[model samples]
Target chain A: MLELVTTDRGSDAGNSETAVTFERLLDLISRGDREAFSELYDRTAPRVLGLVKRVLVDHAQSEEVAQEVFLEIWRTASRFESQRGSAMSWILTMSHRRAVDRVRSSQSGHDRDERIGLRDIEPDYDEVSETVEIRIEHERVKRAMAQLTALQREAISLAYYGGYSHSEIAGILSIPVGTVKTRLRDGMIRLRDELGVTS
Target chain B: MNDRHDDDDPRLSTGAYSLDAVSPDEAEAFERATDASESLREETDGLVETAGLLGLAITPVTPSERMKAELMAKLATTAQLPRQEPVAAVPDASAEPESAAPAAPTPVETPAPDARTASTAPRAESRARSRWFARPATLVAGIAAAAALFVGGGVVGTAVSGGFGTSSVTDASAAGLAEITAAEDSQRSTVPVEGGGTATLVWSNTLGRSAIVVDGLTPLPDGKVYEAWYIDAEGAAPAGTFTASGEGTSWHVLAGAMNPGDAIGVTVEPAGGSTTPTTDPIIVGQTA
Candidate 1:
């Protein structure tokens, strides 16, 4: 039976728990184990869909992209190198890239200039569940985000979540394109450090 | 102006690129730099992984139920990925089979709905034969016959041969394609063209590479090639151009940066290609 999980019980168990388990699941999937692939999909699809939805914003397109991502995982299971990082990270990275691509290729690509023309508009914050673990993670990112200057946070969010390029973010923020790039770089570096991302 | 920035700190943008905060043009430049240096690619992968963690900050939302069902249906009919040695097997294997239940019924339910998924052979061999039979003389009738047979038998045969174990050139390319598809940064789109042909575009803006493959085209005239263009409202920008192999697969590598609003198009041109398309585009695919 497919266990439909509403939460990441893996997180509650600890980071290593989910990370190691997901790694093993990917390994089994590589060995042509369809069951293991299902488990991996169940465990990761929520965040994958969530991440894609955050970027693309359209429900149907997000689903389409998410489906393709999973299909890719099925085909490329052997390519997952455990030495690189956790399976969740790999899956999320794929979701983010695919979603960003969908956004960039869609009408948003051309319409972006108009959207970015709206200077000083607030970036949309994706709604989060009030669950303790999720809230804790969100609060951690928020705290790390607090360390950035307002301009830095704005620049990072607009680019990362809004799916706008640096030039587009620059237009939106009414800053030099160079300034937008610098702020985004610095903000990501700080955020990475805050999250203890050694890589 | 850009030259000085490159000199000051060429790698400074790696952070932003990892976050996908840069334009496609900037991304192409960043990848060209990274591709030349293995260490640079590793560093970029690390940064991308780091940035990917921010995804956890978003509240998880479950996808629709249809997704899982469709995925299972696709997997069941399609040939499974080639199996590797069970070297990576987990010792606590008992837990593995429990999750296999939902996917088990798929193979029984959907035997062969579509030829593409129904055929168990690696894409190259199957595609080659399919294209040959699909040539103009008997094109439509041949495709119909092939499709009917494609669904009738191969599924059971391939399942039995899942990994009897032999490596070949085709397997190697399939592996490479898998790696590309599995790449965290790659994007893909498949579009159907005129005369029952299909085109697939797989590109990685971060890698500074794009590939377009047109399959099942009726054999073009000798000394002719299909030219590719990146079209926007302004006009067409020449992408790399190429001729199809006898099997009717034409592959083009596009190194130029692509922006949003750019759609990929193909036109029949003389060998090599022209400064501008010489015919109406036979196929056009939107990029976004």
Candidate 2:
């Protein structure tokens, strides 16, 4: 079931070359190297745009936010700290935050609630053009996600992919806010453990 | 699984925060709480990294070709922030102090307005009039300083000379520096030292951690060192002490958790270090 909307991006865990290249590119970008910024944008734009589109589901707005994300990356390249996390994580985390912010700020409660009402149906993943590397990661994440209980999976999906707040998720799932928080937390911890993510 | 009422458990919110599932206010509160607890912050970072992996689960989408063209064109006008050394290298006598300091103080230097602001300025005048638009350069400098704080994780190099063991103190302070800078509510202030250098203080009120980076100050003579202090209404408390290297740059993680409204000050003291500051502060950066 998870495979329906699952496909991986080019870089994933254990790919040290991509990580090093990102860090190196950021280092150069910080020094005003336009070529490095261009390269960095080319490498990460698809994932950035993909993640934004997943949360927003609006093509034009998704593109706008993706552009803003790239501009932010360009302006704040010096802020990338290798010690805290990977360059890719930093970029994607920023992208996700921006997308969520847009969703929360732009949409009214009624509109968001209406969207949440229809959240159970999964979005189709484009499988025709994906690479083998992407499929491997998709399967790995799908397997890990499969381990989550239905409630946990539902809570995580609404919060992450749907950009819904816990209270809104509570409203959608008809559970108490506290219960929603617990489910989200437990679900993430389980996912982290299953994926073998280490701090 | 039991439906645990874990709203009060701050740790639970780490997941929501990582997923950007909480409201901005909740995220702020979580960040404040996480700032105070290193373990919580570490848990949050781990979860955030895990959530980032979830981003890769979707199929890739190629943006319109014009997007890249527009971005490339925009890049021609945008000014990239200056690079900062993670750890201040051995002071070079030939290097200009002004050049060594990350981000100059002038607000006029950061030309090229942000693309979003530029695009929306005419239509959304109210929205475009944010603090960022008013003083873009200052905002730029603050961001640069914050970024410097992150890369400056090892700014604790001088702590070794201050009598703390080299490896352990440096490692602990580096981690602390990273935590404070990464905190959502972290604040930074830069003040010019009396002697010619500048001291940039980065602190998080919730985390109670602060560090100062001093640049361009004249290297102190033998038996004299710079002492840091946390000053509030009642009195001053000694933070730590360290001498400037030959190049006149020093980074020290102030000792102990900071109290609310405490201001960070640095004064020169004797080599062994003083229990109390013996002279006037050469520089004071308010963290309140």
The candidate that wins on lDDT is: 2
Candidate 1 Cα deviation (angstroms), residue A73: 1.8
Model 1 DockQ, alpha carbons vs. true complex: 0.21
B44-131: candidate 1 lDDT, tens digit per residue: 7666766676777777778865466445434432333344346766555433332121122122122232233223223432232233
Quality class of the docking in candidate 1, CAPRI style? incorrect
lDDT (10s digit) by residue, model 2, range A1-199: 1121121223544663345367788887776555577667777899899999888877778888898788778767877777666677788898898888888887643454466456542434435537666566667677888899989988888888888888888888888888888888889989988877777
Best by the DockQ measure: 2
Per-model TM values vs. the true structure:
0.53, 0.54
Complex DockQ per candidate: 0.21, 0.25
**The TM-score obtained by chain A of candidate 2 when compared with the true chain A:** 0.83
RMSD after CA superposition, every candidate: 19.3, 22.7
lDDT of predicted model 2? 0.66
Give the per-residue lDDT digits (tens) of candidate 2, residues B28-126: 789889989999988888788788778876776888655664454344334555455656553652243321222222321223333432343233322
Q: Give the TM-score of candidate 1.
A: 0.53
